[model samples]
Target: MDLPSDTPAASRTPRPARVAVVTGSDSGIGRATAVRLASQGMDIGITWHTDEEGAHRTAEEVRAHGRRAALARTDLSRLPDAAGVVEDLARELGRIDVLVNNAGTGTATPFVDMEYETVREVIDVDLIGPFLCGQVAARRMIRQGDGGCIVNVTSVHEHQPRVGAAPYCAAKGGLGLLTQVMALELAEHGIRVNAVAPGEIATPMTGQEDEDVRRTSRPGVPLGRPGDAREVAAVIAFLASEESSYVTGASWAVDGGMLRMGPQAGSHLESDAWRRP
Candidate 1:
């Protein structure tokens, strides 16, 4: 982490307005995170794989907050140059201070029935993509000689598995460990890394597309409903902010207590008359 000779002392000051690159920010949790980081006064770099229009909409929200916004198209699964978008955004925004690796895809096919290509695709998107993006961001941060942050948007599956989502579960679990390793390596350079694992968020990914979480109901979730994308974004924003300066290599759960229901669920069942094996 060598500083340039001309770097100003003030540039090293705490809490300076910074820049962030958020991948797959066209909609859902990515969109909410871009907007929330904007509201916090950071210029944003937005990317999309398929939703160009939604990316523009997210940029509009960022500009509405009076911060600069840059947009690009990134397919993390195909990394011709994993850092290309980060370089472009850094050139446009002048520096990269935060990187949120939020772009990912999943499949619900059972492990036995899953196609090899589908499993590869999920791993490429969920694990490999973030790994490359984080590496690029870290290199940039090290070159800039200033601390930075990286937040990987994992899922409850990072800690627990689902019935038919073997690839998704494996990739997320891999990413959770990757986050810790990145944190360990980058801490010496003042770079922080962490993860946010959300459960049943009301987003397009969960088939809730734009639905309000407050209006939704879920009996299985201890909190009584799915979470909002914004709710998850709030935790991400914290991890990206100076407020979490001391936090690194940690995975914060924003799952509305859904992760706690597994054991309690069986115990709470009313038809438990037989203990015979």
Candidate 2:
């Protein structure tokens, strides 16, 4: 956490504008977050894996809010190289004030039957990817001498494990701890870090793209329905904004009370179907 020769120990000056880079922003939670942050007056940097069209759509939405939007193709599996998207976006946006580590992948295979390559890919994309990207964003924020924030998009599995998603659970669990460590180490540099864990959201990853969440029902959840991507985005927006300046090293669960229904879920299961993917 060494500061640049010209960088001050801390900066108290007000900024004229803010910029944010959200990875995996081509759709779902990432797209919603980019749009929400844009509406809050922050220029957005969006990244896509395989959906250039979706990334452009996100950019259009950001521009509609009167904020600038920059696009890049971010393949987390590419490792150290892919993390450079943050630096590229920061340069394009002039400066970065926020970074949402939203890009991730997961596996549904059971631990015993999983392939090493598949596990490696999942961990690389979900855990190490965010680690490197967070470093890139944080170093720039330090050099800029401005206090900033980073929001790591973990999952509900970060706190609890699923039977068939051994690798997914492991990566998310690792990310949850990584968020805390980053928060602790970066506080002196004025960079706050936190994690947001989402439950079953109406996202393409959940096979519910553009689906109305209100029409869905989850008997085990107190809210009784899947959450909308916008709902998760709202929490991420809070973490990225100054409104949550004092909050760090915490994990916010946007799970419709599903995490609290652990024991109930266990007791109410009618069959062993829950044991498989």
Candidate 3:
């Protein structure tokens, strides 16, 4: 593949913002997605909560692709910042054509032991943040009187329950419904809403080494490997493009095959021998 710095520029007409806004884009799937979009000739509005350096690196990659990249320092845990964040990007970029709600957080904890603060933060970031951004983007698109696309990055847990991830699951589940609602509400205005539910991607959020995350994590996947950031990004790009004019309110899972098994442990049971009558 062409590294951002090595990418050849393709010419295109200038559109407002001419860009895509990717939250949590300083690293991981967000970073990869931002760079991939830039390579396709879109400018980028990148958001980061903590990784300024990583954000700059992504901006550099965007520049390497001969596209503009603007970085914003944002913490989605604060509910009030969501709309403001979208507004700020709009002001800086001139327009918001594509909005990718990729910023989120989760923890591995039992629901009973979960603290309210953690629950609040996770919900605010994973669900409310996207809601706010989507609301703002929809209004803007309506005002512009042109169609736009919204892609929310969710997870497999949005469909299936997971152990030790109550708030995360709740937030993503809420987001899943929100995507549908937005699609319905915005469809008449020429806006499309969709989501990408990534299974296991080797990113910083997973807190696993890239190589190890790719290896050990894939045994359950029919494809036999963890998803790369680029794989998920491709889905987002397609949703953002005119190519997906008929697609909306759909969550595309990027996880290998982890969700296909109802109970991972049960897959090992193999019956009969343990049931002594």
Per-model TM values vs. the true structure = 0.90, 0.94, 0.88
Of models 1 and 2, which has the larger lDDT? 2
Tell me the whole-model lDDT of each prediction, alpha carbons only: 0.89, 0.93, 0.84
Global CA lDDT computed for model 1: 0.89
| Candidate 2: C-alpha lDDT | 0.93
Ranked candidates, highest lDDT first = 2, 1, 3
lDDT of 3 by residue, 1-277 (tens): 2124443356543345466899999988999899989988899999999989999999999999988888889888877755577778877887888999999898877678889999999999999989988888888878988678899999998998777788899999999999999999999988999989998888888864254544564555677777788888988898888778889988888877667766774567677543331
Tens digit per residue, CA lDDT, model 1, 1-277: 2335676777855645699999999999999999999999999999999999999999999999999999999887676475488778887898899999999898866578899889888998899889988888899999999789999999999998877788999999999999999999999999999999999988888799788787888887888889989999999999998789889999999999988887786687676342221
RMSD of each: 4.9, 4.4, 6.7
Best-matching candidate per lDDT: 2
Candidate 2 segments exceeding 4 Å error: 1-14
Task: Kindly provide the TM-score of model 1 when superposed on the true structure, using C-alpha atoms.
Answer: 0.90
Clashing residue pairs in candidate 1 are: none
Regions of candidate 1 where Cα sits further than 4 Å from its true position: 1-16, 80-83, 266-277
Better of 1 and 2 by TM-score: 2
Give the clash count for each candidate.
0, 0, 1
